[model samples]
Target: MSQFKVAAVQAAPSFLDVAAGITRAVAFIEEAAQKGAKLVVFPETWLPGYPNHIWLGPVAWQMQFVGRYFENSIEAGDVHDKAIAKAARDNSIQVSLGLSERAGGSLYIAQWHYDETGELIKRRRKLKPTHVERTVFGEGDGSDLVVKDTAIGRIGQLSCWEHLQPLSKYAMYAQDEQIHCAAWPNLKLYEGGAYALGHQVNNAASMLYAVEGGCFVIAACALVSKEQQDILCEGDPQKEALCPVGGGYTRIYAPDGQSIGADLADTEEGLVMADIDLSMIAYAKAAADPAGHYSRPDVTRLMLNSKPQRPVMAFDETAGLAMEAAEGAAAEADVVEIASAAE
Candidate 1:
């Protein structure tokens, strides 16, 4: 088993400020690097901030501000790619961070990885955005849900609530993901009521599930404050329904379901570090590997096949035989119409 130190960064992201978020992330990565961490992971959608407001129940008819909120999100391109890559290269460490990915015209909950040299390694879009998130981000295909081979082992990622999906977890387990990156925003108070206990319980359950699957899980969570919430939900008090202040449960778990690292205060920006040995994976799997042993493969198997769908347009074709025929017919019709008019 190869030994490596991993860090789970728990921080607060500035709302709608991509540059500032990147800067803060870079600082966290540098701090982790100084602490001898080879790889660092950040919470979900830390870039451009998580739009927690959408989850705050139904919007009032008068409050059309929800749509305007998404307009401030960031896109993935040279600006973000270069900045993030440079951070990884400068620190000489692998980095996995979540952000809102603007693809074509739609947004996706995306996680991106960078190698030690600051090169883009892999990008995984969230399989499904939870509840109101569907209103803002698009669903991702299986193609983007993957584990990539890296120097640190087979690293994989799942954003927020995707960890709750059984099939999604199985997909990563089947790929033999040794290091699983789980990103999440801080759970907040719901407008109809106070903080939901279900959010924290689900988070813990997901962490334990990762360990049960024989993987080292780095769970990162955002730290939202009352001031931040106030800024995000200024005009309409209903926006308060989205996310309340102060619920940071960032943690790291081992393959044996042990809490290896966590933040005690859950208020400030910090990181939880743990030493992970890849050799433990073999030991854990020997007990029970869902995809390997203790399975009834003869009964059923899951197979995924995907095809690309391309958009069609009338003018896009091999030559223009149809166009020529149409032109000739139009000329005949014009002549007939002119003759009829003369008569």
Candidate 2:
């Protein structure tokens, strides 16, 4: 019908301080709302902070800070739900914020969305954790890849490096996602090599992918500073954990591979707004659709099916079955023994 206004909020989050981060994020949301933002998206791990210690190698293992990191992380419970919902309702704007979710004694990089009425809209977890992040974060199942139909548009989410995985992006595209949320951490300023290039390339790739899929893409990245490092990094200040300073390249792109805003500052706390005409998607898709005219189903096939479930047994039945099965299997294997003459 009409163009929608979306904002990509780029800012540095306080380390291990959920309350303070939420407070700061709420202020930004208020500002964006005041500027007539219909939807506002945040960077990855903006709730508390990104666990940079995991990248410290041996120091991270010996420090055993993951427990403390999980302790300060947010849980997807009523308390957090209420607080976030209230923030969205107060601002009268739809919000999508990324955070470290602690659930079932496991940690996941998660994104939570709240509607204008303060109702919880959607919650999605990162499909796979990055290289070092696997040691601290758990993998998400298919249930986490959700594309919900919202008032503004059909919104979907993918976190950090997951955008690099073609299959993951295709999954969202197949569902016809309108507004894709791609979240990432700021590139390490000191580790200037493939890591930095990967960040920039991945962001550009995701935007291009969205264009190919004919969807609006919002690429949000965390902006960490020396002050944020002081709070997040619990170890020595001179260590490599805090070596990288700031790398905030938050951006917004349209459905035609056009950049709306790019190369934003780390400390600048504001909204990067764009007016997206949903009709552009129809125009682009008519030319080339990946799943339609562009795909060759004759030579190639990708079929996914659900696996069969294992049988379940009662407690006593399980114990007896295990013992009997073990004894039978062992007896059939070998029956050779030597007798001692002295005995």
Best by lDDT: 1
| Superposed Cα deviation of residue 28, candidate 2 (Å) | 1.6
Cα lDDT for residue 301, candidate 1: 50
Worst 10 residues of 1 by lDDT: 334-343
The number of clashing residue pairs in each candidate reads: 1, 0
TM-score of each: 0.83, 0.82
What's the C-alpha lDDT at position 311 in model 2?
35
Best candidate (score: TM-score): 1
- Residue 324, candidate 2: Cα error in Å is 24
lDDT of 2 at 248: 70
Model 2 residue runs over 4 Å out of place are 59-64, 195-198, 231-242, 304-343
